[model samples]
Target: METFFSNQKQTLSRAFCLSAAVICLGATNNAWALFSDDEARKAILDLRKSLATTQLELQGEIDKLKADNAELRGKIEGLEKQGEDISSSQKTYYQDLDTRLGNFEPRTATIEGVSGTVQPNEKKAYDDALKAFQAGNLKKADEAFSAFANKYPKSPYLPLALYWGGNSKYANKDYAGSISQLQSLIKRYPNHPRIPAAMVTLGSSQLESGNKIAAKKTFNEIIAKYPDTDAAKDAHQLIAATK
Candidate 1:
């Protein structure tokens, strides 16, 4: 009976020991699961921090780009304004030059007792032609004007002298000679202010010379080239009369 009681107590003690081991294993497993959850949470927080840093860096780059763009735009606007100002200044300068060139006039000769400060020959020749014209010596006027033109081919008055010589020829009943001389004047003085006058004379001479087509052409040319001049107005009247 004593041996049986000792065996029973040993069985009970083994059962209790087995129960304590099972409880200890269950607690260790739960603690290990809790530690794993904490590590996963830490990793998630680090990932969120990394994402925030990347986003901030991207925003900084965007801000820098905007500032650079603004600076470049300002510079471009300044250059455009400068270019416009330069263009306006250049236009004004050219306009002033054109005005000055258009208003220039030749100085007159025949100063004091002397013929002229420059070009004494021109003064003498011109004075001789005028005197003959005033005296009503048409033939002598023609001779003086012809001599002036021939001797002073480079003179500014050469065009006027030729023109008056043609008029003198017409007055002397030399219509064919007048036509020839006036045509020569028109050819010689293309840009002269007296060109319209020469054209009118040439047209009249051409009409007298029986060159009706040439007369019409000269009248039309004067009206087209010198629309604002009195000679053009006269040419138009004569053209209407002829037609």
Candidate 2:
């Protein structure tokens, strides 16, 4: 009976020790699980923060690139506009230079049924002299026509100039000058359209110079050569008056 009780006591003690060791192991496992959960949560938070910072940096870089691109586009447009303006200015400058050069070059022109190459200065001179004559300045007309005739003897305007010069001299009562000019025109341009009128002037100039015989002879020649002309009618009347 004593031995049975001792065995029972020993078994009870072993059971108590085993139960305490199981409780201690359970507590250590729960603590390890809590620590592992906290470490995982901290790692997740750190990863999220790093991702957010990287996104912000990337966005800043993108915005800077956009602004740089816009600035580059603006500079390119400004350069293009400047190039266009310079090209336009150069074209206008060249056109103006060409026009200035054209004035010095000779050009073809037609004047009074005569077509030829005429110098710019030559045309201007003729125009100025003709303008003076048409303004009814008789002395200026005479001088200008005479100068033109002497200066440009080979000009197509010579016959007209001589005719107008003779008429101007006659109007100024320059009888000797009129006779000389008209005779020159008649001798030089016998088939000219102004011949009949020139001969009539010649007849009148001869009469004014007291050469009636020469005047009568000129009137008869006009009636024989250009009987249908107005100058011939005037010549006939003048001859009747003289007779």
For candidate 1, report its TM-score.
0.49
Candidate 2 at 187: error in angstroms?
A: 1.3
Q: Of the candidates shown, which would achieve the greatest TM-score relative to the real structure?
A: 2
* Top candidate by lDDT: 2
Q: What lDDT score is found at residue 179 in candidate 2?
A: 92
Q: Give the TM-score of candidate 2.
A: 0.53
Give candidate 2 regions above 4 Å deviation: 1-117
Clashing pairs in 1: none
Q: Tens digit of lDDT per residue, candidate 1, span 7-95? A: 99999999999999999999999999999999999999999999999999999999999999999999999999999999999999999
Q: Each prediction's Cα lDDT score?
A: 0.80, 0.85
Report the C-alpha lDDT of model 2 over 49-119, residue by residue, as the tens digit.
99999999999999999999999999999999999999999999999986666568766665555555655
Name the lDDT of candidate 1: 0.80
Q: How large an RMSD does model 2 have?
A: 12.4
Collision count for each candidate, in order: 0, 0
